[model samples]
Target: MSHDKKCVVIKIGSHHTIAGFNNTELPQCILPSSYIKKGNDYIFGTINMLEECIDKYENESQQTLEIFTTVDENGIPYNWTVIEQQLKYIYETELKCNSKDFPLIITVPHLKNELANKVVERYFNLAFNKLNVPVFQIVIEPLAIALAMGKTSALVIDLGSSGCNVTPIVDGTIVKTSVMRSRFSGDFLDYIISERLNDLLKSDTFQMTDTDGDIILSNNDSTTRSLQTKDSIDIWYESNTWIQDFKINMLQVSDKELPELERYYKEQAEIQIRQQEQLQQYSTNNTEAKLDAAAIASITNNNPLSQKKNFLFKGNKNSKQTVSLELRECYQLSESLFNPALISDKYTKEDGLGEIIGKAIKKAGASVSSVGTNTVGSLGASMTIQPATNQSKNNNPFGSSIGGNASNNSTGGLNGGINSLGSSTTTPEHIYSTLLTNIIVTGATSLINGMEQRIIKELSIRFPQYKITTFANQITMDRKIQGWTSSVSMCNLPSWELAKWYTKTDYEKESNKDETKEN
Candidate 1:
């Protein structure tokens, strides 16, 4: 690999795509993996960008536009062309660079053998032929996570918008049979919040007097309006937009944290009420208020505990809408992740996220015991030159492929085989213990404020002995890039060239050999 040429890493998730040159701490382009084609003009990028474009076009009726996206319920790319376009947009438009100038390193999930093979084959063709690139490498998303966390092995729980993937990695390889998935994810939480917000809007407690409503509606600050809106309210077209914003800003706490914040709000409201009462007391004596009915009514109106609570929303038009939420209702929505019965009556014990984690861990432990520690993670092995198979069927360019035997490299990839230490381990119990100790939690779903803590608390009740590692701040909002960081770091190593694919000279030689064979 030449130092002069550009080296690029792309981390594509169900929600977003992150891309940048290697060695940078942060990615240059973080775009949503969504595209909408309206005639020849296409719309793609972050959700915010898409919203802006939608508003610009003012296309309230969405029936005419064709939407292209790769995300499925399980977070796998269903259409390779959509993914290819996303990458193409990043390379050609955002980065303003030719694909052939950069060696591409991309990430894929550990799933069905047939699916991964298809994805990899498409990538090779896209890079080598369409983009005219030099070399392409594929990294398993979970193994890249372990590398990013500076761990040889860990149980990675990726809670994404599409779904949750609980995978166990041992010495940098994913344990295929131990992997588990669930449909419940961040999108589910958003739906619950939206429902709860609508329910609150309809509650009698949310209504306010005309006078109180006037005071709240006149307030400039969103916080003051939120504090005062126990009165009247308005509903608008941006209900979903504001509900999402409120959840991101306010609903990041667990059930435990909610009570404390609620108490604080009550105390502050009481203090203000008491001050007003004191001012009124100075003006009139208690004995006089007994005879003066207006004074008595004023005192009755001063009770803070009975005051109206407010949730204020400002929409795209600067139009104001207000609703009130009971603190219990706010936190109860988040609990649906743990107790699916809260979301719907049909949910059983097996539907909970904790139950899914427990089952995945148990499966991983059993596989480790069965493999007997010597080859615990054979499925997640490092990249290697696979025996050249006939490419006419799939058009797979890299006879070299991933999911080979594990490599001993500390950084996790472009190595020979499973870690020598992993192969030499003697005790099955030790392997299980090691795998259970470091539970590396990553993905966009884990970004919710108290999400990591709640998962840890729930798992602790079930498995007290095993540790839970959330890698809290180690991952950014664009959690997919954590894996790209690891891959970038690993590829920068001097010895990475040992796993290099067909160089320009090598590609030429292979092309001639194939031509001769065809003749």
Candidate 2:
């Protein structure tokens, strides 16, 4: 990189954006990708600002702030203007750097080549024209992640807030044909939890409360759902937040273990109830019969099991309530991730997370197949082939051709492509064992205690012949710094300055040439 220009690397994702100067090993700023737009002003840089904006708007129902740069179902950014503003805020305000003095290296996810290309073009226009930045470089997110993990080839799985991105990288390049994505991610789990909680609140099993900590009854003598008030809405929001935290704290096990864990909690809840009743009876007998302090002291001071069994929620007005979450309910909540059909009204398991991973693995194998063993510069990847299912010619599940023209076939269906590679050496089994063996799982959702293990277990069962090694950095710093780390590493190389960064003058000249041609 040019010594004259300060350089920065940024990793932009649907949930958060990480940015910092190239000289630093760690990111200088990490901000949530959220903003509230007012008439002529925009508030961003922290979740607090968004919360403040929300509170302000809630108070004045007539003036609602517009949310921007929110992630869509496929983990892609929805707004360009907000994204630019976020970058501008980070560059000028957070980092205290002038755009003109620095070049930018950004990481982006490939939501298929065309959409990815458009997003890249949009960023280029924003950096070159709007921000007047001196230079810019784009790195695909999977490639950056792979490089950060110190692997030239691996399966990169990003379970972000909005969706899951399964990308296979070989020799530090994204295997575009093998990449797969789905909207089923952390947010879906949150949604299901909230939905289940709402149902629980409406049922006779739980009671609603008002601001003054008073019980609020359902309209038809507790037979109907309780009326939703501002306090209820506040409680629901806080409950969801708590549930999200709970998921990270708990919910780690194989699907079979979920039921057992639930039953354990239920038994603990019963034990707690029995303990409470016994304590009450002992207190009543001692007080009524005028027993001494020594008799009261004989009872234990603490019960850890009782504490663990308790579940509580509060209304916005500080009204408190408690109920033990049924073991079955807890099991069902986590189970929804592996089997979406459980929550879906139509009961379709076609889009489950495991299925998505299997399909992605298949695509990775196909990509390796395309670059045959005999080809020069090939990674010498191997696989164990299985027979493919018959499918319509138009709907090839594995987007890329297994043994045919790789360039033309790049997208595939979710279910049909898992076994399409015929008898190739680069089968799912081989790919999972060799080049793609180092599974690097990243993103906020991966913080859930057992998520990494769950993936390893599931994939291990799917491809028994392969060794399914997985790596997940639980630290937030490591998760967000992958793009920046890769960028810094690239900049340190002698050829990077000459090879990658595109300057403003070059961009303007190209734009002018295009305009002139159009005229």
Candidate 3:
């Protein structure tokens, strides 16, 4: 008997992707061209690489392969092509169906050679032909993260190299996939950095070659010493740039001068405003307000669940479900996304980007609160019993005009000794009806752990007699810069202990087999 129940989640990353790679210590990727000009150049190269990966799949075709990319409403990438053969490695995933012990979510990358007739579509044929037990669920990455966070609702803002994506997750699921595609990320930040670096150097000419993504700095002056990220490139780019700007603007400026700068900025802004006013005639604006009398209308706008009308039901009966339903959008956040910032936030309170992310989640319209202890559980059992009157009657004789004690079991009666007993039958309405409270919160650190705490506290209150508990988790991520990294499991979670909320297992009936009926 296999005690090991295998559950997995795979998160593939761009950094892990291998396309036109040269892994021979010379360079990680040796593209045909040093500097890319046309977008097709990258695509064509990527396609060729995908073609090469088919050989690997041919060898281990037994594994279930599910190829999926984040989709727009229309199913296009960058509004162009969905990324399939991207990541060269693997990650984690959670399951779609409910499980008390939810499966560990994992990521699977479609290799460069894995692409056959398509780009990143996972080779599904393996599950049908090769693997005996294979299951698959495809979803957008950011959408998956929002789902995993266990939110009541939110608008997810995932800033990455692929793009700066904004998605609204209403209830526990997604309303639309197409409108959430973002085309800006840390890569865009890098581009901005490079552009700013050019402005700093006072040159219109410079070449940025990502030799295995090693940020190298070589000046025409020849003294910058080819600054590879291994030494200080990432430190300078990700961390130092912000510090440098803050220092340059604030260091020497006096408190008295600060007011002057503010005044000057205001005057400049006023002038700019006049110039913008002159241009407003040509500009277009149609803004939507948060509290417009149309919040419900807005909330229901992108709901995909509503589109799922009963294909079988013939009549136009109204539904009792007033809340918005969700379609599963399974995906993962890339671990390599802003590696340093995420790491830094996990360490300190100030400038905590992690908390900013958490706050963003709340701002997207979610209910958040700490859990307290309360408990209630209900069960009903029924059996038949003979009926009896609560009142006593006096006996009567002789005249027989009236009889207070007209006993049915008198000698004249045949089968009057028995009477029908009222049964204590239960109906569906008698169930311990309670709402599964959905709470969404985000902060500097331990957002998930905080959620767990809230969950434990709430469960304790909601079901006091039952024991709540949790299994230990050991998670890890990429390297860090400063501060001692307390073993890297649960990055968003702080120094939190394990806890669980167990249900009352001792029901009137007992069975190892869980038998649930479909309504």
The deviation in Å at residue 490 for candidate 2 is: 4.4
The clash numbers for all candidates, in the given order, read 6, 9, 54
Residues 18-128, model 2: lDDT tens digits: 888878778888776666566788877665554654465347445645555555667667677777777888988778988877778776676564465456557778888
Q: How well is each residue in 28-47 modelled by candidate 1, as lDDT tens digits?
A: 88876666666776667756
lDDT of each: 0.60, 0.59, 0.25
Which parts of model 2 have CA positions greater than 4 angstroms off? 3-5, 47-62, 204-243, 253-323, 373-429, 480-499, 508-519
Model 1 ranges off by over 4 Å: 3-5, 47-63, 202-244, 253-311, 315-318, 375-416, 422-428, 467-469, 474-480, 498-519
The prediction achieving the highest lDDT against the true structure is: 1
Clashes of 3: 54
Higher-TM-score candidate of 1 and 3: 1
Candidate 2 Cα deviation (angstroms), residue 50: 4.9
RMSD vs true structure, all candidates: 9.8, 10.6, 26.4
